[model samples]
Target: MTRALIADANLIKKVQAGEDPIGCVLCNQACLVEDVSNPIISCQLNPDAGYELEPTPKGFFQTRLKPTRLIKNSIVSIVGSGPAGMELAVSLAEAGFEVELFEKDRELGGALRRISNAGVGGVWCRSLTHYLARIENGRIKTFTDNEVLPDDIAQMAERGPLFLATGSVGSSCHSTMSGYHNWISSSDLLKSPLPAHQERVYVLDNKGDHESAWAVETAACFSDEVVLVTADPSPFSRLHKTGDLMPAISRARSLGVKFLTFTEMRAKGDSVEISKRFSPQRELVQDHMVIEVGARESSRLIEVDGNQTRQIFEIGDCFAPRTIQDAIREARCYSRALLELVAT
Candidate 1:
């Protein structure tokens, strides 16, 4: 299936010929975000990949009109450098809005910077080279390591709309638990390598997303024993949308990883409390716990000093925790509308 995602007729020809071979970087963000029921597979990085025309109410096909670049001297301020903020900045710039982006981190790419360690060969992240180059050339003004606050938003949005793509923070739900010590955020996995030689590990999988799978899989490699704890009926249940679902599940089981399904963890006392849905609570101990059910929104409404066409928007994970595909698609959709708003 991974190989199937690599093939496209004309794309294959170009790849072989060493032309613009990266027509599809397989970022896996764009093509699959569409609802399975009403599927329209398109590339997140390249708008032309599968998005050119649309059907009208009269059942007639019409070319999707490009945003008309306005001559206004307006500037849009965007917070965060994650997928959503980066894409939105580029889209607004293309539509003739001057963009100023801010990121607290020294570099761009947000969570993807950490994800570079993964096996995807950096091809996908490199797809942003066009816009990243633009930053170097000063087409878009970027301020890395400069954190923007509500007051900053108030001031920036005075010129135009302000968008908060500030991404997310670790979930605080399980933090109040008594035995919540020695746990690492799921984000830790993306950021760095785990220490060697742990005796046992507990992987928390409440959200059942890719991070959960990664946590369990990583723990299995180093720890003597691994246990997956989830409140859902199954482990990595949300992974049915991706190709890694079955392989991850089967591999976990084969690697001596135990499943504690229909169970929830709150306290990490002498023995960790495992609250079961249908029965009495249980307890177990582990050397470390990886909380993969991460990300609470970090954005909040900024009280603009004055209303000078100052619109505020929250996109990507900040709007709500979601997949990279959702983050990109969300930004793209918002960009189209934002262009129209400023054009008028």
Candidate 2:
């Protein structure tokens, strides 16, 4: 049977390689036959060395092998269910670890969710859903809409090593001057309603990032004659490739919004002084001035001493503000380190 299977595989390969007028010869079989149009050959011969065969979908023969590995039981706990947190938990659970994932938001995704709200599609959300499904099917636990305080970390540390994926918060942009009541952070705009606009408005783009551009666009929706001034050469340069900046630029142009590049605003009364990159300094009079900047890491939970009785590791934006890819990569590395320690 083995010899016959190998022979069939070789014949198929030869046929696939453009072998024409091929003929099959079998010995010592009264029922032996061959069909030239769709050749079929049967024979009973000695199996040869260095010969292998696999079954094909059409009841023919091919060559391949299925891969397999062993899974072991272990226990692991992960904090923050952003891409990083969720990815780590899923990977550990799939590797046979009893994994538990915790998230402060009612939803599992973190910054990815917020970005989606900016009219972007949810690619990470779909991927996360698939991973969470696997974890649930494997009996892993997920805690959502729950913040992990310092005490919570200590208790979880008692069970096993605790991995922190707490994520980051918006950075502060407190202007040096007083009574610049118009200054507001991009995060604040995202969480709360935009302030009532005046006839002429000035937006100070401190971050030169995408979220800031988003704030500017939102403000342009209601404000009359919005003027955006940024220290960077272009608006939302950091997130330009993500398709965040193009729409903003296009919308501002359509709405007759004026954009000033490499410019900084010094607000005074109903006017803001502007310093351009390569021109005479001038003042732009406006009723309001809005400031949009970037974010910073919020690692308060991990900062507290004795927060964890065992070894504690920090991952994701909690360490530094970064993309989802960075978060997942860190989580994977941390999980491997934990496995190595446990083995030792």
TM-score for each model: 0.68, 0.61
Which residue pairs come into collision in candidate 1?
179-268
Error at 294, model 2, angstroms: 1.4
lDDT of 2 by residue, 137-218 (tens): 6656888888888877767765655678776654543453234556665555544556776576666776655456556666
Which of the numbered candidates is closest to the native, going by highest lDDT?
1
C-alpha displacement of 303 in model 2, angstroms?
1.6
lDDT of 2: 0.56
TM-score of 1: 0.68
Q: Per-residue lDDT of 1-344 in model 1, one digit per residue for the tens? A: 43223323356676678854333555454456448676866665654345445321211101112122322576778888877888788777866678899988888877755554333224434555544654565457889989886666657755666788877766555453434666666655554467577788788776776567666767877789888988889888876665556776877887888998898776556456677889975666544654545634444545323334225667787778777666876787777655544445
Question: What are the Cα lDDT values of the candidates?
Answer: 0.64, 0.56
